[model samples]
Target: PDRIEILLGVGSMTVPRSSVEKVEMASPEQNRAIRNQWKTRYLLHEDYVPAGMENIARLLTAARDARDTARQAGSAHAADMKHESSLLARLERLRSELIRVSKRMQNASRTSSPAAYNAMVLEYNNLYAAYTVGIHELAEFRAKHPAPSDRFSFYLDSLDALRRAYESALVLPDSGQDADRARFLDRVARIIEDYSRDFSTTAVRSEHSESGIIVAVTVNDSTTGRFLLDTGAAVMTLTEQFARRLNLDTSSLPAIDIVLADGAQASARAVILPSVQVGSARCEHVEAAVIAQQPAPDIDGLLGMSFLRNFAFRIDPSSGQVTLTQFAPR
Candidate 1:
């Protein structure tokens, strides 16, 4: 037979030899080493970034490695290490403030009156201009000092920080009311367009029906189903049939009391799913409940606050489109 046989713990299986792609054999020690390397390899997006940005990222990585090496070598670099720590602390504070400002701008856009929105826009524009000037100054300093020095790491860190700040600024809601502001944003978008794949905003289409707004949800990246967009639900819920399809062991899970939409009380199993995704937005370790029956015949479950809380989302009445943005806290 032109097939390969595999021995399982309690059974045997066979697969067509032609279906096999490739295989590798390694000792346990070698396998563990390879896995460790993979685990430590962060920021994989740098590989695909533009060459100039990639070079900057590599320089930052090298600076980090040098800092680590200096730390391991003991007391000789103590003063320089203290200065590095100070610069990093300042950078972190700047990043936190920028995130807070971005969140404020988003909130104002969504909920504020026209006058208030315009006021916030003016404030944000001023802050943006100030940060831009600071970034230019940092670049000028870096250009003047081409050779590596004690302050070189700070320069690279500041540039990276400003780049992230620009990304955050881009996510701010723009009503296009101000021509100057719109032009500034467009220029910033062009500068960072290549690096903004994981942009903070994502849009997912919804279906409007008698059962309410419905959106497609993916569980554990394995199963997908239409779920009613239920902001009132404290946790996501799955019908017993859907849970079974996901191979969730409801019998072994703990039971919890739930209040139904019809004002009836029922007991259901509680479970935490590995992940739940709506469009490009994904959240991990989401709490979900498994009920005995579906809420609606067409819907498999409810897309509850458990998943929605992780984002700032709005459903447009005219288009039935849901816009989700990463929620940054003030």
Candidate 2:
């Protein structure tokens, strides 16, 4: 059995092991008990034990008053301490800013120079042109050895070709060249090769049934459930209700100058479709039509170039399935 001592009450009482009792404190003891209400209320404790907030505020106000009185009394010491506190705060901020800038300078020194960004952009543009040429070359290669079923593997092969070309162009030594030298060029080329290999293509659609370069797509209108798969449209558009279901605002979008397939132009706008699935691919920020009533047949939605731009797409008539191969990055 452990010895039990009263916490709130000063006097001690003992009882049977299994029993518990309610005890009341005497008035004098109660008054003494209130001073020890909190553990930190002990004077030697390290934590801040504020005497009522209002009282602390008054003390702070008195400190300010004392400072002011010290100034009036021509005491330089008190004035100097207040000045020093403000000066130290400013110096601390300045020191922090200097440290931050020094870190940035160190990082910038380690990474790229100012000319490096421009050099990268230039290299990227050159690689883009090279990729376009590679696309044509790859098409010729695929015609010589055509296996459209294994498009991913085909893309990887094309990527390997591009990498071989890029690696052949490398004059950079492993440990000898600067970090942003021709090694940077190798990285950009490899990135392009990698990007071209994995991108997906969109399926094209036409009205009622499928036609050349056109696939079948379904669209449901709120007023009329009927949908027309329109190939004549350069961009796919959704009805106002469909747009709402896609959680898009019909208004407040940037107006797009859309040139139609008929060479006639229409003023349209960009709308983002978050959840539209294109052949099992989940796409975000899918740009759809905000404007309606085109020169050609009005479609609930038509597959657009923005989708096609991601892929090297060819509609195979022999197989009814529109084969969307991976992107060629042309």
Candidate 3:
């Protein structure tokens, strides 16, 4: 035989069996290793796709098609943008020519020669009409490729194509209904997670802050302060000292009773700060708990889920860098 067709899940691939020195059924360990390798490549963990061969194949196929479509769309968009730029350049040149002709026509009319003046007027009218048409064409081109809509279409097309592929895969043999639904939901979740990083921002930890992973933050649109990144904390906490320095109106703000990390219950003022900023990531009108007692020494506040929820963030302890990816609008 020239080749051996091996059935892998629901899909089959032909390979030169002769090139293989040995052929043995893969052990459970070997199968797990192979799937693990694939899972990493597809960014889909074992729990994401369910425990079945056909479901695996379907997920892989959907991912592949979506990736391919994204690549093709990107290339096409690049070429289209280049073409549009060229068209704009030509329009600019035409406008420049029209301006030059208008100036010449004005000089001709002042020369006191009727024939020359008449000829210049005729030429100017023709040039103006042509320029008008060029402007209209340019406007049409821009309207055809509006920036926001073009970006939205690319994402929409990729998602729609992947969805359709997934739906088609559901009908394939060995794809159980429960398994298919799980895989589809997981795929959608991953896509949503990735999309959340679209407007991602990054910030470096402050070197001046000594105790913990402290980063620079803006409070109430005015005060710039250092805040600690405490994942354990449920909400944003501002130190009383810092709040007083900023002249925060604590009296009128709502009060929240919270248990301190040291197992002590404390009364804290709940105030909506005008804005809180971490690097390029900023969340406006943020609700923060102002504690009269200092949570830690020197730090102005604690960066908790109240502001962190707007973006998915990761802190590199070794490099002292905090990367923030905004998943939602303010």
Please give the RMSD to the true structure for each candidate, in Å.
29.5, 32.6, 20.6
1-330, model 3: which lDDT tens digit per residue?
888888755346788978867768778888767765665555354334544444444545555465555446555655776866666566555545656766776566555788887877777677656645654564466456533323334444454455565556556566444644565556665664454333445665655354567888888777888788877666689998889878864543335687766678889865556589887788764547889787677778788766775565667767878877542222
Q: Of models 1 and 3, which has the larger lDDT?
A: 3
User: Which of the numbered candidates is closest to the native, going by highest lDDT?
Assistant: 3
Worst 10 residues of 2 by lDDT: 218-227
Worst 10 residues of 1 by lDDT: 42-51
Candidate 2 wrongly placed segments (more than 4 Å): 1-236, 239-241, 244-247, 294-298, 327-330
Clashing pairs in 1: none
Clash pairs for candidate 3: none
Q: 330, model 1: CA deviation in Å?
A: 17
For all predicted structures, in order, the TM-scores are 0.42, 0.32, 0.42
lDDT by residue (73-187, candidate 1, tens digit) is 3243344446444444443344345556666666665454888777766765665554444433433433443222233333334434546655665465655434434444454
- Could you give candidate 2's per-residue lDDT for residues 1-330 as a string of tens digits? 654555544234565545555556558766656644543243233233232222333333343343344234333333544643443344334334434443444455334576764554454445444433433343343344332324444444444454554455454345443432343344445455445534555554322353323344332211222233344554466655545554444343335566655577666655434334445333333346655653234334456643443344455555544545553222
Error of 3 at 294 (Å): 0.9
